[model samples]
Target: MTYLKSAYKNAGIHHKMILLIIVLMLVNFAVFAVILKYIFHIYDNQMYKKTSEVLNISSIGIENELRNIEKTTFKVTTDEQLQRYLLQLESETSPYTKMVLRKKITNRLIAFAGSETYVYSMVVIDKEGQVMSAGNREGIPQELHSTLSELADEYDGSNAWYAAGHSSLVAARQFKSFTDSNFTLNGLGTLAIRVRIDRIVADRVQTSGRDGQLTITDGKRMIYPETPLLSESDMQAELARKQPYGIATYSGGTFFAAQVKSSYTGWTYLHMTSFDDMFRHITIIKEIVSTIFVIMLLIALALGTRLSGSITKPIVQLIQNMRKIEKGDLDRLEEEALGPVPFSTQDEVGLLHRTYKKMIRRIRELINENVAKQLLLRETELKALQAQINPHFLYNTLESVNWLAKANKQDRISEMVEALAFLLRSAVSFEEQLIPLRKELDIVRSYVTIQKTRFDERLIFQLDVPEELMDAQIPKLTLQPLVENAIHYALEPQIEPCRISIVARVREGSLFLRVEDDGPGIAEGFLEKLHSGQVTTRGQGIGLANIQERLHLIFGAPWGMELHSESGTGTSIHVCIPYVKGDQGHVQGAVG
Candidate 1:
């Protein structure tokens, strides 16, 4: 075992994988074979149970049918009217009286035979040569006297049943004198009822699944079927076994044989099912499964070889690249043969190759990073100086304009100047990305005031923010862009007055600020174009998409802008943010 382990450890990965796969397939196939055997065992058990139940039920049915036949024979033999008529017919010598007596007995026999579907015929024989019969047969049966003699001697006064032919049976009972009860034992005549055994077997005997032959015996000979499928001696021998039911062998063929003995008639009902016939499909399935297992083993071997090679080839290439790097041949690593496409297989080997390449590039980038950093610092300083100068100059100019308008008694001009100053300050401030709700709304109100002066009654702006939530912190410029979008898409297109409302509410630990307009809604597919930055705006202003990105950067997921609108149903934009009270400190790094 130690030597084998050492050999396996020394083997290449491809060969190792192939060996492991073969071993696994062998183990799996062994388990499958065991499971198949267990399944077959269960199937055999089920078949046995079903066959036993059918045999028992069939035997009971046949027994009941035979009992009914016995009752009919008993009723006919002890019938007082029939007994008196038979005796009178035996002693009377007048032709007309004899004919009348025989007719009456024949009518009684016909009635008895008609009452049972399985009964074929009925006959009565007095002590003399006279015969009275009914149904199917017009005259007496062959050797009726001898048959009755045998039955009378064997059964005494009880009913006796014996096979009449291949498909029929005869039941015999001694008709006795009913006038004198003490002399009832004296045989006045013989009454025989012929039964259709085929009908009885058809109605009562049931075969289970598959092909099987049914044979019944009177503990003497085969009766129902004209001929036996098995040799008579073999069947009798199987019946003679101590076991009531089991598998037996006859003439080198296997059979499942079960027998039930009738309690009333003492007949044996044997069902012999050929083993080959019952399990022919099972045998075919075994062959098919074995063939499939062999085929799968072959396929697995082939696939294992290919898969092992595929897994190791990428690793081999990576190792070769490492060897080149060891020899200081880094230039050759970037050639067409070692390009990114060659190592882009989306596996660990590919990732390692890519990481190695990135490390090489990072080393070169670090060598020049110091110089690039110095230049970037100078450029940023110059831009910051310009940003400070321009915003300060703009605010100072707006203040001067407000003073000039107030001196001229131009109230509208002063109001527009103040609103413009406020809007400019809010847009230029880069110190905080989040501000109080009241401050953001103040900026929005200033912007709306300026727009209201321009549109007058055509722009009906309504604000419904609750006073309690005015101090909640939110992302700056959140509502300004949404209000601007409503004006552009909702108000500017129509001549009628558009009612634009901003409503704020607190829900589920968050604050929702909705901006709605009672104007024609934006067209379908326009929102998608807007989000994709395809819908170009007229001036230098932030779009709704910018607000969405800001919210995502500050609050991560699920807190962002949602828009709902339909044609002629107006438009509403909801800005969702976490409701944080008081100063939450300045959010860092996202102001720009």
Candidate 2:
């Protein structure tokens, strides 16, 4: 139970988990806001678009109705009986005949007016400013009479003439008489039809509450609804100019208004609908979305708090364990006590725990093994170093005796002893693995000095070394062995003086040392076998092989020794190494 609790505590909430929740919430909110805003805008625009379409349709219907009324009035004005009565009145001289014609004309006009619902009244006026036939004079304003008289003067006795108003529409036609082939005139008379504009408006306004209010206006006055509308001066100013169907607001409410201009008579029609009714559905949807968002937020908060704690506890415990490891408390690490701390998931943290446990086991094993190997290797190197001293001591003792005899003028015997001493010194002192180019030169000089004494001018030696490369390091006794081999093969059996040359110089940032002997050059197969590590000569010893190995180890295979020879020309052994002057210790112990 305690282990379980510790694991839970360690697995604390990840910051990424919290951040993920925040991002999700914000994204959801943003998406909801976008959808809501778009839906509301689409709904509002569609409502206005649909309203405009309806108003346009209504204007067309009203225009058609007015047109039908004009057709009916035109038929009545051109009737055969009315035309004949007017023609008879033109020739009537008797007062009794004149009265009869007048009565016929008046009756005809009265019958036509009563037959149509849209025609409020009809009237005939004579050329002498005398009214002949009239209907429903009660509804006709007195001020309109003079306006009618002016309209009559402009009429050229056509089939029909019409005028439109905010509340009504009117049509007028002039009457003329025809007698035989000549036209005879009694009086110029006018026939007029009056239309009820309110009835046409009533047909177009819908009764649905969501359809909003409808209003009609002329430039100067409100006609339909017949009440004051859009009382706000600012709103009124905006509506005063004619505009096609679009959204606008007034003192009472916001609305969409459409205007139609009549082609038959130059009158403007306005249709207005309130904005409040158009967007009512959108308000309901917004309220629903807001409520849902609140409820979802409450649910998310409740669930997130609990889940975050569950995830965070185990992570916290893991962090504490890591801190203990950092403090070097490896023994205190509760490996078994860590017990399978349930990450409870197959993700990266679980993999990390498994990997860490395996790494700890491997690390402990490596640490113990490394410690043991270090001690053993140190003891073995010490033994190898101790084994190098006995040969060097014996060679030094022999050299001391040779120098003593040379001081006593015992020259021939001293020379032989000196040669043996130098050979022994070169063969020993293997522990001093690297020596300077100058030191190698000194060893070679000592060997050559003894050789010259023994041979008595039969062997000639030349040494050419650059001053700059004198201190460059090489393997100890590297050049001495090569020089000995050259002397043995080239001069020991020669009849006259044999020329031996040693040259040391720096070439292309590497040291080049060459030993050339002017004697019958090596056997063709012998040089190949020497470089291939195949021993060829009966007693060649390991001199050349050892030098090649040391060169290979110090400077790698490419920078090692190369032998060039021709049977009669002589043999030259060349050694190449990177010039490193101050790296004596590294040169002495470096492995090929």
Candidate 3:
């Protein structure tokens, strides 16, 4: 309740109605008995800590399938071609070379007993005892020549589990020939394998249901999964109650068990359960929170004694309509909070005076839709700056025909109409969208003086540019559409003459410039339609994708343009800006 209105808004109204009726009846009986005692301590200590995290996640998936059957019994017992065909089939007195060294060691134990599924069989015995089995040798039942002398007198070549009298379990390993430790001959004979331990702990005791009772052991015996609640005196009173690794609570506490152990078959695992069928949902959430905490404590002491005299008159008219909504007059909260909330009853101070007049009509429709979306985004950015005004009236009629060709003295028609009126006043400039690399090299020297009076002497232009980068800052006509996409793709067609350079450097911290052009270049089907922008028509006035979209709309997304072409070795292009100068940094948004 807004923390009981900021802990009884400066207590006085009969000590804030008896501290809101003794803090809403002791915060509803101490948060309903601390949420039913934290859901009975998460269902009796998280159901034996989720059965020791499902027996340590089923002993990490049966120790990754018993370390892939101990890496397929150490790759068929360190196979030097199955140990030189089991040391030449132990001196083959030739029964057809001992049946071709037992068909090449049974085709390499048919790839570790045809790859896993709990690898039921894969034997390979040797040192003169010739045995070469593969998978499901009927999941190994008995006589491997009377347990090869009880597995070479209990040889510890590792993986030694043993059992296999039908209910499987035999992991065995015994292959000796460490290639001549004096032929270490007595036993290159047992790789038994079998493996079933109820199919390797059957899906982790099927997730601890049936009130548990899984078992494993290996601290000297009990491996097969014999049940009847682990018999022999309930497996010595459920592995003698008190846990060693994880869960515990014994029969006296109505059971819980858990355990785990494993570290690759040192086997312990345990499991158990019961505690009234594992917390029967914390005893059905303590009988639905003791019947909703005794029917919300008799409906909060019968609406706190019929809300003690109009609950301090709607919290003193909601503190004088929240001091007239904290003084920022919410448009006269529908005429001063509707004459002190005429919300004729229906609780919580009439839903706080109809949610304070629906929050002052959603704050006057979000302040008239944010002042009509900021005056329609400033009338769509001044109608896109009035479409760059009519190209400044064609640069004021090419500055009155370059002052009537310099009052008729006609010095080359007034320097080609003053370089076509400085390329029509920097192409109708919309307030220096970044300029000065000396007015973008005076609009690329008046667009190479009107493309050198129409390619006279087959056009040749070079600019090496660096009078301290003629006052750096770029993106105006970013080097006149890369010198008009290098005179419309390296000098129009190609009757030879086309050298156009334009350079400018400053490597790492950006600001490159390039442009180069020995002509006949960009053709591989229009340089893959100008690097896939699918370049539409216009070639010179503005095309290399409109000066690489005005160098990513005036130097923003890491500035732009980068076309280094090469057909007959020509087109260069570069551009890439971001050196920044004038108003030292802060553009980051002009993608148009």
Candidate closest to the true structure, highest TM-score? 2
Against the hidden reference, what TM-scores do the models get?
0.49, 0.58, 0.27
Worst 10 residues of 2 by lDDT: 159-168
* Model 3 CA deviation exceeding 4 Å by range: 1-24, 31-35, 49-89, 100-119, 125-131, 134-170, 175-185, 203-259, 263-298, 305-307, 310-592
User: Candidate 2 residues 522-568, lDDT tens each?
Assistant: 88787777777675322226567777887777677877888888988
Ranking, lDDT, top scorer first = 1, 3, 2
RMSD of 1: 21.2
Tens-place lDDT per residue, model 1, 1-592, is: 9999999999999999889888898889889989999999898878887777788898888778888889988898888888788777767989899899889998988887777887778888777756788887433356765776568557876888877556557888888676673355677788878877777777887773357877788867667677666787897788788776778889848998877787767888888899888889999999998899889888988998888777788678767766776787745546632454454477766677777777767755774696698899999999998879988888999999999999999999999999999888888887986788899888889888899988999999999988999888888888877788888888999999999999999887778899999889877799777766577443337777777888888987667888888889899988887777655554432222
Q: How many collisions between residues are there in candidate 1?
A: 0
Per-model CA lDDT versus the true structure: 0.80, 0.68, 0.69
Q: Is 2 or 3 the stronger prediction by TM-score?
A: 2
Candidate with more favorable, higher lDDT: 1 or 2: 1
Q: Candidate 3, clashing residue pairs?
A: 490-519
How many clashing residue pairs are found in candidate 3? Answer: 1
- What TM-score number comes out for model 1? 0.49
Query: Which of the two candidates, 1 or 3, achieves a greater TM-score against the reference?
Result: 1
The Cα RMSD in angstroms, rounded to one decimal, for candidate 2 relative to the true structure is 9.8
In candidate 3 the C-alpha lDDT for residue 523 amounts to 68
Residue 173 accuracy (lDDT) in model 2: 61
